[model samples]
Target: MIYITGDTHGPKSIGFNSVDGVLHRFNSNNFPEQKNMTKNDYVIILGDFGCIWNVDNESSSEKNVLDWLDDKSFTTLFIDGNHENFDRLYNYPEKQWHNGKVHEIRNSVLHLMRGYVFNIDNKNIFAFGGASSHDIKDGILHPKNDLKLIKRWKHDYTKQFRILNYTYWELELPTKYEMDRGINSLKCNDFDVDFILSHSPSSSTIDILGNNNYKHDILTDYLENIKNTTKYKYWFCGHMHINKKISDKEIILYEQIIRIN
Candidate 1:
């Protein structure tokens, strides 16, 4: 079996809320648990890997998270979240904090801003890391689980931002790579993305949920239009922190499948 989960923010130190410290509800232990598994199982983490960019610390959190899903020792896939720093997403440090304990100072995951494709068990899946370049003006933690937060984050027009530079990080795929890799295939008239998991949902999927009085972002409209006309199977995203489904002529938005092979 395969398991997919999201939005876990944890710190490593034995501070308050630590495994032996305070009692917490959303600690690293929240990762999915399974039994009767095999080496073929898979696990997908949508985004929001942690609260800060502490790579060494984050590794500990990840270790604990992985422990919960250890029944079959599934293969793991990670999507970079806005809260995560790109530096640690690609290059893990080679230092050790203690004997036999390694401090991983980087995140080992595919970080695609525009999008990417993956081949798994003879099935192809596409994804886009929708990490926002803007600051988290709304604070990292929210008390409300209401969809209102989702809507606010989606339509927070005031926070509109773009990629300016990323010279310090190797974790993310270059912007050029993200833009250049797909046009040809999308325009090929035959190739269609199987699954697209992005950190930020395209404005078409997210904005369309809003009242139609507002104008759409031109690029968003263009991409969605192309995907619809091109014929893709599905789109999965995490930025809004809301699980939703949108049906279009080209794709089924946010549908879950147990197996694709």
Candidate 2:
């Protein structure tokens, strides 16, 4: 079976599992619905796995999440969300897995690269993961001088308080190269895919959902192009944090976990 779910920010126990000795949540759940799945089954996370954060100093929470995922019966696959630490994630060696390129975080956990096609269970799957973080406006201010008070202030106090760039926000949108790569890959396969997986929904889907606050970004534009040109049965996304079908083909996921195959 192939299962899919929304964001899980570093496996911090969304729910408990007594069967697994109090270590189940999200894809690692010990619920009856997932009890039948074995190691052969796969669970793909849309984005925001968050296991790679603070790689310089591994926290207990991060370690616990990694250990739990490593012991899981099913393989966990994820894409790069806006909250991920790009430096750490990119350092991992990229290799081929399940007919696609992925960053092997562990033997059981994998990070799916942006703009790639994979052959899973004889189904051609197109995967793209990235989105503009809406919370960039809340980022910390960068200190203009060596003054400690200026640097430590939490609010906009003076003219020197420029919003710190690259602290909380990340460049999570897809690059032009990644966009072209995905398009070319689809062209090679005659633009046919069984499914499309992404972190953010296309602009058209967002419009249909009536979400006007989302910033117009290049990634969303690229996804809109894909929606117009690509041939796929379903497109699943996660960044919206809502459980609803934006259209007949596009679905937004949040807390609910669903089976795709």
Candidate 3:
């Protein structure tokens, strides 16, 4: 079985801070369907799997949450989103799974790398995860010399501000190499895949959603190109925080867990 859903940022509360990670959606009470699942089954989060978001050392809450997830019967696969701590996520040991590269976060949890195709559960899946943060209207703050920006921002409640290397990472967008790799991978697959998974939707899909607030950059343009060229059955994305079907072949997911195959 294969299931797909949106972001589950982190635990509800890390220490004393309240969060919006929405980890509870996977619990037995909310997603009781997992009771019959096994390691052979897969639960894929589109992106923003923010359990790995702490800028510093892994907190106890994160550890507990990861362990709790590991205890689940099904395996978990995810990709990075803008909210991820790239410093931590990119450092995990790498491994090959289902013929694709991954960051081994745990025995059952894997971070699917960008620009790769994996044959899992008898299905071809093209995975690419990333998105620019749309709410940073105040712009990204630099940590060049001011180390206390986080404290100051928290105290002052700065509007729509994100700190570099701490809250915001330039890697939230795809690199040129990643784009090339994706194009090469698609060429290898003859430009066809059973599924396309990403953190952000194609620019066309954004237009379909009729939302101008979403920014268009290299990543979205790359995705738009893929959307134009690739022969895919369904494209699933997660950044919108809304659950809707943009078209017959594209979906933007959030919160709800849907059994896909």
Candidate 4:
């Protein structure tokens, strides 16, 4: 079995400081209760691995996130998100913890992109990633509002799978720029995703964070049109920090599944 979740700003962010505690809660309550969990289980953390990759100093809260999952044997998979400093995450110096486990290890041996696929529990899942392009001026990716990241993908040909957008600037910058690529990927390449996991909610599952009136309506119409024509399964997203259900095929929280017919 595979578990999917995203939009954790990290342990040090001022507004989203309790993320570690929430991860612990989810791990303790949700991980143990699952009947399908096993040594072979894979956990897919969509993005936002850390709030700021520049903080070389370790915070106890960040350590707590590692400590909470120390004993887990599952193969954890991670991809980069916009909030995360991509270069820092990819090149951060490694250290050892008192427990003898390597600290601050980035699990991304693979680069995240639009058509990559991984097999978990006998099922094939594909991931497409897009974070705001790194700002050379400010050296930060999140809190950036320039509807200009739309040109990242040159082509989109995902074989029926899931869409996980890990960009944190969703509300302030709904990545309206990314929409054309997303829709074009689906339409031009004849690709259809069974599920989508975006860090910020788009078009209504639960986007109360931004109250994104403009993009949500656009996304809604697009997704609805796709659902009407195809046998698409579900669209699962997080970032609103609230659990919401938009329809039979869309959910606005973490850990939801859709069985393709």
lDDT of 2 by residue, 1-261 (tens): 888877766645544522111234454333456567667788888887767777455578777777777787777788877767776777787999776789988888888888789887677899999888775443444445434654465465533322333234345777788888899888887898999999988887777777666866898889989888889999999887778987788788865678888
At residue 225, give the lDDT of candidate 1.
Answer: 58
- Clashes by residue pair, model 3: 10-21
Q: Name the lDDT value of residue 211 in candidate 1.
A: 34
What are the per-residue Cα lDDT tens digits for candidate 1 across 1-261? 445544443434245544321013223354324344345655555555453355444555455544532323454455665556565554444432211112242232223323434554444555444344334344433224434654565566775322212211233223555545555435443556555555454656656567343334433454465556655666555544444556642222221223332
Tell me the tens digit of each residue's lDDT in model 4 across 1-261: 666666555643344425432264346454663344554665655555553344454457755665555445554444445465444454554443211122145442222333233334544343444333223222223322432332232143332211122232332222454455455545543454455544444443333344532244444454444445544456555544556667776665443322222
Residue 108 of model 1 has an lDDT of 25
Cand. 3 TM to true fold: 0.93
Where is the poorest 10-residue window by lDDT in model 1?
Answer: 96-105
User: Which has the greatest TM-score?
Assistant: 3
Candidate 2: residue 16 Cα off by (Å): 14
lDDT of 3 by residue, 1-261 (tens): 999999777767344433245467687887899999999999999999988878887888888888888888999999788889988888999998897899998899889999999998999999999998998887788877655665576666556788888889888988889889989999899999999999988887877788878967888889999989999999999988899988898888988799877
Residue 248 of model 3, lDDT score:
92
Q: Report RMSD for candidate 2.
A: 4.5
Cα deviation of 209, candidate 1, in Å: 2.9
Give the number of colliding residue pairs in candidate 3. 1
Local distance difference test values of all predictions, in order: 0.44, 0.74, 0.86, 0.44
Off by over 4 Å in 2: 13-24, 27-30, 55-57, 138-169
Give the lDDT ranking, best first: 3, 2, 4, 1
Most accurate candidate by lDDT? 3
Query: What TM-score do all the candidates reach, one by one?
Result: 0.56, 0.85, 0.93, 0.52
Query: Which ranges in model 1 have alpha carbons more than 4 Å from their true place?
Result: 11-33, 55-72, 93-115, 133-174, 182-189, 211-226, 248-261
